[model samples]
Target: MPGPLLRHVDALVGVGVLVWNLTASQFGELSQQLDQGLDRARDFVTANLPITDAQLDKLVKQTRDGLSGSAPDPVGGARTAAEVFGSILLALVLLFFLLKDGRSMWRWVLRRMTGPNRELTAAAGRAGWRTLGAYSRGTMVVAAIDAIGIGLALVLLRVPLALPLALITFLGGFVPIIGATVAGTIAVLVALAANGPTTALLVLAAVIAVQQIEGNLLEPLVMKRQVQLHPAVILVVVTAGTLVAGIAGAFVSVPIAAVAWRILDTVQRHRAADSA
Candidate 1:
């Protein structure tokens, strides 16, 4: 009996660790594109070197027809915000539910397991709290660090829309690989337009280097104490999640995987003990 109890506890503890891992890497999906940069330097050279002054003049018709009466792109700086009104409303609603009733809901789950399964119930609760707390805290910190770093880089580059881009970066950083990749791409693309494709390429390279440092060096140091999973497993889950849930699925795949791993692993170990 004693051995069974200890094993059950061990399994739950492991689950707690898994949850933390998912929470921390939310912004990494976006970071990947940043990692594999756009190779702007090569492109810039190719585009510029191939053309002489006269060729450029011919293309732009000696800058006469090019600048004759061309008005600015009507769509530039077009919308107030790219995020739709509905996303904002949904976020507010989710925040309310989590803040006010999230705890009670877990208590309700624990309450549903009848009879002598009380210990199992408690284990589940521990797993839930660990998942929620670790993911929330880790993701918040990572996103903040990412946003600040990228924002500073953009500022140094004298990129326009720095503040708006920073805010977008912070929000997107919450989504893991895809989020960072998309957000940073936006930054680079915007930079390209504002400065030129060459400058944008440089900005893109900077984003990738920063992400590598964060993932290879910083993440391991910080996450060692949080949750641990093999890299291959994470890749599989991310892929599967994108297939099943699209963006939402991809964003949430880790936490769900963590919880599933925790719950299933816990139950299995306990069952083994019972049979023994």
Candidate 2:
């Protein structure tokens, strides 16, 4: 097999193993953190939306009755709000580095494209940089879009911890086959805990609908131009990552593609040079 292809296959297998182990061991922790955050979220939602007019009237009466002396109702619980904001900040920081320093980062990789076949090195560098950059930016956009859309859904549904849930969605969107599912599951579980089983089920259905839209429509339309790996390859890599290092392995697959691509391009260049 070709160098690049073999590397990709190896990575896929490794990542699949990682993710599976992580899911089995850590899903409970994710669920737990989600539940803890939901408490604040529930209060935030309930306080914002009192179902009945009498509830609305009560709020006005309380405010008029000198409730201004008390602390205002927070939008989310401390931990939940922290989770939401932290994720957004983390993603934005990643975006900043990707957009701003991508070329510089690739220049380091360019150094490896050296020796007698300098032209080949340059060519591969160009291709590698372009391919990887596109993937990075495209994935970021997909994550952002997913987060916003689902956040709005949660808010409208009056689900607690909308922002935190949205953050999870954004991060989860990065995972190929299972990222969104894991993230969406958190939202559903929260809905179950904070609201009821029916509400959780409905939330799960909404997540499924959105993911279908993203997979069938957005991924092909958006990421296709950026990332050249086939959907089958992507799925395999994710599964492999999950199996190997769990979530961490799955997250590393796409990033490693650039390296895998570079190695392939190098081998291709050598073959052409030899033929020449």
Give the candidate number with the greatest lDDT: 2
Say which candidate scores most in TM-score. 1
Candidate 1's C-alpha runs over 4 A off are 1-98, 101-105, 229-232, 239-244, 272-276
Candidate 1 has a TM-score of 0.59
Tell me the spans in candidate 2 whose CA falls farther than 4 Å from its real position: 1-116, 239-247, 262-276
State every prediction's TM-score relative to the real structure: 0.59, 0.56
Q: What lDDT does each candidate get?
A: 0.67, 0.72
Per-residue CA lDDT of candidate 2, range 161-276, in tens?
A: 67667767888877866788788878887787776767777888888888888877987788675466776877888777767755667987865764476658766977878899
lDDT of 2 at 98: 64
Native-structure RMSD, model 1: 13.2
